[model samples]
Each structure stands twice: as C-alpha cells, then as structure tokens.
Target: MAALCGLTSMHKIWDKLFKRGEFTELDVDEEVAGFAELLRERNARRVLDLGCGAGRHILHLSKLGFGVH
Candidate 1:
C-alpha cells in the first residue's frame, strides 16, 4: 500500500482513505510527534491547514496547543 500511494510521500494521501474514525486517531500521534518539533522550533502557534477537508489534522493540532487559525 505504501508504494501504491508513493510511500515516500504519505502525508497528503494518508487521510484520504486511512485517517478516519479509529484509524484517524492513530495517525494523530505520529504526525504530531514529527511536526511538533518543527512547530516548537518555529513557534508556529497559528496553523493554516489548507485543504483541511474534514479537519482531522486541525483538531489534533489544536489539541496540541496550536491556535490553528
């Protein structure tokens, strides 16, 4: 499945089919773990989540203390 969705580029397509319901919560930890480092370093309090779609990422980001604007 990784190769099919371009394993190297997984983020954008991950939620399309995988990030839903129980599975949605699973991805949250990993995405936050990875991006949190950057957010802290850059002090990215306000997040502009383009193509937010159902807003799964937005919710997670907000929980982590981001303004999520």
Candidate 2:
C-alpha cells in the first residue's frame, strides 16, 4: 500500500498496465478487490500510488474509500 510503496515510477507503470480502457467490468472489479485485499492485509492506513502519473490507482483507491494523501 501507500506506506510500503515508493510513490515512484513503478506506480506509473501500474497505471498503464492496469488501465481499464479495454477491461471488462469483471476485470475491473477483480482488480479493485485484489488491491483492496492487499491493502487490508498490510493494514495500510494510507495509500500512495507511486508514479501515479495519471491517477489511475489514486482514483481506484479513492473509490475504495481510502483517504489518499
């Protein structure tokens, strides 16, 4: 999660790689679930999507009710 990530280039790559442009609803849902689960397991109180150039993960985390800083 934010506390564990670098908030660097890797996040930008994730934004592109996880782009939902061509993803189906199920795929998006799965991604959200997976991300949320990871955060939960990490007990992350904050999340920072590294290199969130386009804010993809930022938006996703927000949608998941995370108070991104």
- Give the runs in model 2 whose Cα sits over 4 Å from its true position: 1-32
lDDT per residue as tens, model 1, 1-69: 758668646666665657555345435656667887689899778888786465677787788899876
Instruction: For candidate 1, report its TM-score.
Output: 0.51
* Sequence-dependent TM-score of model 2: 0.44
For candidate 1, the 10 contiguous residues with the lowest summed lDDT are 19-28
Instruction: List per-prediction Cα lDDT, in the order shown.
Output: 0.71, 0.68
The segments of candidate 1 whose C-alpha lies over 4 angstroms from its true place after superposition are: 1-29
lDDT of 1 at 62: 85
Residue-level lDDT of model 2, residues 1-69, one tens digit each, is 875567776767667766855332333456767978898789886776676355655677877778788
Each model's Cα RMSD? 8.2, 10.3
lDDT of 2: 0.68
